[model samples]
Target chain A: EHPLWEQIGRSFVHHYYQQFDLDRNQLGTLYSDTSCLTWEGQPFQGKAAIMEKIASLPFQKIQHSITAEDHQPAPDTCVLSMVVGQLKVDDDPVMGFHQLFLLKNDNDKWICTNDMFRLALHNFC
Target chain B: EHPLWEQIGRSFVHHYYQQFDLDRNQLGTLYSDTSCLTWEGQPFQGKAAIMEKIASLPFQKIQHSITAEDHQPAPDTCVLSMVVGQLKVDDDPVMGFHQLFLLKNDNDKWICTNDMFRLALHNFC
Candidate 1:
């Protein structure tokens, strides 16, 4: 497997760990120090800030399964798409999500520059 | 090149032709017969409806440059990201756009199921 593929796989595992146990340390390394994580225009910047925000989430447990994965690569950058099935709060299936990850290669390591996801939960409203 | 790669390249060329001359026909085939194209919350469904919407765009001439491309593939689907530089309307350099394409392969051909793009134009406003 290409190094980029390994990085992406690692990122997903890290996400699973964080989601299952609310492990802040596992989640922190996935993002850059200056990275920004936004949901519905609310931005959380930096590792500490992002961890704090995630730790504050009311969900007790999360189980995410990647139903599909796709990648498009240009030179050193790649975009990853995952159709995610997530179990959140009360262990109920909240919604399906489509996530887009924009990654760049920095010093032979892949780092996610932008991550955007949409939930089917909105359709229920 | 894999068949999937060819399909992706063809899609980009099709996009350029549509953009350059306001060609409605070229634009219509890029999407599925039951596809949905949405910006903000406005959704355009089906081919004829989407073409009508594009034909209404006031841009006279458009030039688009793809600064980057990336792909991720799983089974039969792939996601593409294009950092597009566009010259639109009145020959002004309006802004850059990041376009995300979610594609599915049906019977050996690829069709875009969803397309999302963000314009730097919004940042200026």
Candidate 2:
């Protein structure tokens, strides 16, 4: 991780979780107008669609345990992170997730442009 | 995965492994002129840069065991696949990798635009 980007990455993720934990309704503010999200197998673009996807998630309580995080600087900053955590709506097994985020830093704030999340396991075995 | 996309996805992965196994140099043909590749935490763009990055990998033999694949249809088709497998140069442990591929279908062929890869494990334990 770049020295400057490490700070930005840590702060960006911290701020994201804070806002998300408080109210997912405000999640739209973290993304640009043209941002996109790929959750599970579905893809949604723009704020309205992205918001709808998050709001419809079956899990009401989500806890993310970040295992590894890496940052790359380019046309846009990309952070690849791995999380093995638990999510509960009623009752669910602990699941693992691998996420990739593409963010743009504008006016000292980072805005996500592309987000991808999928199961961490390659096989049940 | 969509029915059509499933076939495309399987064939794509198959062809990729075939070419990659034959010669890493041939991997460039699978991407467009303006494609981008994010290997581990490093980002490389364009054919020259992407090729350079692949050709320089420490591994002499790489095998990707795709665990799950999901496809989304849009302006450009995006396939999110999780792979956990091995990489070896002379003698190396079987390292697991998670990869995401952003593909565009043009002229009845799929071309990768953005490829991201990261470690699958969040914690070593």
* Strongest candidate by TM-score: 2
Where is the poorest 10-residue window by lDDT in model 2 chain A?
A80-89
Clash list (residue pairs), candidate 2: none
What's the i-RMS of each model? 13.3, 5.4
Residue runs of model 1 more than 4 Å from their true location after superposition? A1-25, A28-125, B1-22, B74-76
Shift in Å, residue A33, candidate 1? 24
- Find the number of clashing residue pairs for candidate 2: 0
Give model 1's clash tally. Answer: 10
Candidate 1 lDDT score at position A60: 63
What TM-score goes with each of the models? 0.46, 0.62
Q: Per-residue lDDT tens digits of candidate 2, residues B1-125?
A: 45675566667766776677668888987887777676766778788899888888776776555555554432324543333443334466555556656566768778876676665444232
Sliding window of 10 residues with minimal summed lDDT for model 1 chain A: A116-125
The root-mean-square deviation over C-alpha atoms between each candidate and the true structure, in angstroms, is 13.9, 5.5
Give the whole-model CA lDDT for all candidates, comma-separated.
0.51, 0.62
